[model samples]
Target: MTIATDKITYSFAEYLELEETAAYKNEYQDGEIVPMTGGTTDHNKIALNFAAYLKFALKGRKYNIFIGDVKLWIAQYRQATYPDVMLIEGEPIYYETGKTTVTNP
Candidate 1:
């Protein structure tokens, strides 16, 4: 059987509220809240390896590496997602006043 999609749409504000106390992480796409599943071994391995390699290679540099749990905000598209690996130069641009979400990567 094919996967079912959520028909109900949720507002950004509502999503933020639910995410505050939700047990699992969910990605916000436009007006849809898509729940995330656990990562596979290969996925986790690659992401972790890349972040670790970059962390030492770029040490003493302005670039910072972030993996999992950190949400990236795409304002124009109204999407909030967790990238496997994110490399930011200088200070991260946060979304609003929250540290969990970032605008610039």
Candidate 2:
């Protein structure tokens, strides 16, 4: 059997099951799966800097800060994406990698 379609399609759950041990980063939008290009040195540095600042500012608080490689799920977009920085407060969602499941910041 062969599948036919004029559009790229994938469910959020199926997207999650893709083999990705190496952070083969990707982003999804409107039923399309787009590979994520690795960030440049400056991009990474900026992300790190922002995460650091959030960490310091939120010390002893319930919230935790994170940087790149962390997946942020936007259900409204039906997609999971990487954000430069994220802050999670209260009961946090955990993923297989021991990071928050989804965040926005």
Best by TM-score: 1
Off by over 4 Å in 1: 1-6
Candidates in order, TM-scores: namely 0.87, 0.76
Between which residue pairs do clashes occur in model 1? Answer: none
Clashing pairs in 2: none
Worst 10 residues of 2 by lDDT: 96-105
Q: lDDT at 37 for candidate 2?
A: 85
Q: Which lDDT value does model 2 have at 75?
A: 72
Cα lDDT for residue 27, candidate 2: 81
TM-score of 1: 0.87
